[model samples]
Target: MFPNLELVKMVADIENPTLFSHDLKSADILFLDLIVSGGNINTLADFIADIPILIITSAISRWQYPEFIKNREHFALQKPISLQMFQSCIEKAIQP
Candidate 1:
């Protein structure tokens, strides 16, 4: 478990990204859900500073989106992710 993990905030719907925009800028890691990310991950990523890692959770294929290309340090996780897969992604994201 991430004992030192401090969750910034959770948005059920990112209709108004400005509400959480500030938090994203200062966040160490970003857990992005394509469904709830207002379908503008690119814009969101651009708005934020250089985030170390981005964990993308989506049902869409990675090839379909340009997030992977835009953010080299990102992990694409399918919708129904297992605990192990999630852990691996986190570990990979944090790796130097």
Candidate 2:
């Protein structure tokens, strides 16, 4: 399993992102999660023009967040995420 620090390192090497919105623009891969209630999901989605979004959440279904879940470029990363899963999500989202 990849450590959180390693994940951060991987992201760091790719490009420096100021906000979640900027990250989406610079990177083909984007991981969006709600550390709280997923309320920001819609806001983030709105900022993402065409980038794919990998969402991590404890919510069982997409209905939990209506605005963000309707996107085809979106993927769900259920909580208790594994390293392989996270990496795969990243790859899939970023792959052109």
Candidate 3:
């Protein structure tokens, strides 16, 4: 889990989540949004390591599984997630 600013800094640009994704080679968990179709899948996948990818998106998002991200069996969230659901997702992710 991204616990603090330093943890975030280790994985992604603190200001621009889209432009960078921390250092995946050493990362354990990743959270990103697949909002655009085709445009970002490749780059996003390049930053993924053998980690649990938690993607935020609704069913309406058109992004396909690019080869880079294809190998990762990620957890996808639909839009309008409830607070309880959000917390549960995080808890589960953090739990072994």
Candidate 4:
């Protein structure tokens, strides 16, 4: 997919969303798993405003984040997501 892009992985305990607050600032993209952290998604969205977020979850249809839906920087991918689909979402999010 993105041969020119570099990837970084950061692990955070979703149960304690505030634990990794400082670390997320450096991240260009976020791959969030909603199932693990049922915390306030809107707050998280605001925290990372202007950055691209790729949400990964099984309950894709249930998500009702109006801000995320309206923003082109946010993307949702259902569980068991294929590489092609993931690639497509990433491409869409990063597009100018």
| Candidate models: Cα lDDT each | 0.72, 0.52, 0.53, 0.62
Which residue pairs in model 2 clash with each other?
none
Q: Candidate 3 — which residues are off by over 4 angstroms?
A: 1-22, 36-39, 57-70
| TM-score top scorer | 1
Candidate 2's residue-wise lDDT over 1-96, tens digit each? 533312221232222233444545655444555444424334555555576445554445667655555646577788788778768766665556
lDDT of 4: 0.62
User: Rank order by TM-score, top first?
Assistant: 1, 4, 3, 2
* Residue-level lDDT tens digits of model 4 in 31-61: 7755444455555655566454555444556
Better of 1 and 2 by TM-score: 1
Candidate 3 TM-score to native: 0.55
Residue-wise C-alpha lDDT for candidate 3, range 1-96, written one tens digit per residue:
335313543332233435554355556656555555435444555456555545544554435645455455666566678777766776666676
Q: Pick the candidate with the highest lDDT.
A: 1
The clash count for each model shown is 0, 0, 2, 0
- List the candidate 4 regions with Cα displacement exceeding 4 Å: 37-46, 50-58, 62-73
* Stronger candidate by lDDT (1 vs 2): 1
